[model samples]
Target: MLTTEIREAFLPYCLPDITDEEVNEVVQSLKSGWLAKGPRTIEFEKKFAEYVGAEHAVAMNSCTAALHIALLSANIGPGDEVITTPMTFAASANTIIHVGAVPVFADIDPETGCIDPDEIAKKVTPRTKAIIPVHYSGHSCDLDAIYEIADKHGLFVSEDAAHAIYTRYKGRMIGDNPKGAVSYSFYATKNLSTGEGGMLVTNNEEIANRARVLITHGMSRNAWNRYAKGGSWKYDIEEPGYKYNMFDIQASLGLIQLDRLEEMQQRRAQIADRYNRAFSELAAVKVPTVSEGTTTHSWHLYVLRVNPAELRIDRDQLIEELKERNVGTSVHFIPVHLMTAYSKKFGYKKGDFPNAEAWFENIVSLPLYPSMTDDDVDYVISSVQDIVHKFGK
Candidate 1:
């Protein structure tokens, strides 16, 4: 039994870990006067590339931009099929649509909530051109298996590492020495925050070069610095491209956040450990699972699954119960295939992917962030325990 009762105030599901240092850094960028993809953004990209052991990194306004540029740079177009899991944010599939390619939905490995490599293999055809495997909740996909399939079929692999900035696969960082391209999110909710930004990393220089041009309205090389010192006014337009560059202000937050990633991650891990310990004993709850291929999980979202048969309350009722206790919660995803856009466009129905649909019905992401205090962690754990005890069948 929990000794502490529910708190008086509502605990938010997410809040970026920010401090005076971050505020001061943003002020510094403002004072510097050059805000559009300036030195700071460049420096952050260089540091991020090195951090992930990639040869090149391009900053973008969002992960959607990075994912789109990744496909565009690779020449994946109409008539091409890009396989990705339906168990992710719509951005994963939306990017494929934006690239003029068909987004092929693959079911996930229910245990890890990542795209099943076997399912990916089954989706391959002569038209299949790429695979955008998302690392769900910072848990890595089966890279070895996915890559083997990619290699056999001569397909491009664009990893959607939106939740995997700190994730590792078989002891290698998710972006380290990538077989293709990897896109990472620096959204406010991520472990590393840039307010709203993303990075596309690759070891291939040609793709990197093209990605650079593709991000800034297709202006010729070095035009990003035309406004700075020793700059030239005249530049050529190579092709039509999107305005997706990250400004210095966001990079200012990114630089400091990147430096503090280890500290933030430690706190998140402690909170996760507490959740795991507390929830493992509950017959009605299943704690998030880290796949064997995942050497390190980024701990981006602490998702818990409730076995409906063991609980009198369904997942929605569980959320309401927690809400009544002043605890906030969220669902990681509601399978992309089931969304109206995909359903109406692609004829996807609920039963199309049973595993993903089942996983969706079972999950509720709890509050887990670096700023959460020990008391907050305990309260969340106790709150969950209380719910289970009250609702368990």
Candidate 2:
């Protein structure tokens, strides 16, 4: 074990970068007594839509809810199938099941861990109604190819952009397409921290309106409006819907977080660059790859691949070693097919998604958050190098 004369505390894998402005805004909301979905939520939605260059934005309690409502709005239900990558959070696929649709897994590009458009094309059947491309690790998937496939198949594109809040493809933001609805997350560790919140952005007015109603218990009018001055107490529920509305407290934090997003994103990019430079020459480590024409990446995670043959230790062992050195790390995902729930229910085997399984075997996500200082970054780099030198074949 390597020990330093001056010891540092264990560094967490990810941390939310919150400022006093967020705290103050939340406090103001608390004092206003308009706690539930109200003016602040509405303002956040409007500003988020404008920021993403979308026609409408609906704030929700979670990205899973946003995705579920997006599928519902698209009218994807029983006997329908949604194509998605296996190398993503379970919520991306689970949302399809929530809407009574089948989630068909597609193989990912081995280099990018994003759904391969070609694989998606092959997976389309008569029952396939939509393509849910997940922006894995904040890298924009091949949107042009996926969009082309969607057009040819006449399928909807509901993007699970949980990791791609600020990612862009061909100078256009991820959530700007009308044919596709994009869902974003403001989970505690997301680039933008709202504790637990999400937003759905789309250009179709009808879809937006349907989602708005569906997120608030299917009520025609919200409680804040009905109880406000000169407002009617009458309300109607046209359909059964989930309670997924974002509260003013969450929106208050989001409103300020949005203001700092650009700067935070820059810091993330700098950290990624530093990691790349430090690991580029190492034979055992494989740095992440970006598409040629993409303008900006949100860099939500800095995932590295370890060549088992070059390194005497396996990916899990590397993670264990990092922990021993007081550095935290994580795995982006375990392929859905490998999870007990999916495997047992769907009768899926380990070989079902070879690409996803292969990537999962070698991947580990390093610490890459905006809150990390320069010294923190250097320590991580040094720790990784030391491990490689000690363990490499």
User: What pairs collide in candidate 1?
Assistant: none
Candidate 1: tens digits of C-alpha lDDT, residues 55-101: 99999999989999999999999999999999999999999989889
lDDT of each: 0.93, 0.91
Runs in model 1 deviating more than 4 A are 1-4
TM for candidate 2 is 0.98
**For each predicted model, how many residue pairs clash, with residues at least 3 apart or on different chains?**
0, 0
Give one digit per residue, the lDDT tens place, for model 2 in 323-393.
98888999999998687877777787899889999999999999999889998898888888888988888
Alpha-carbon RMSD of each model: 1.0, 1.4
Q: What is the TM-score of each candidate against the true structure?
A: 0.98, 0.98
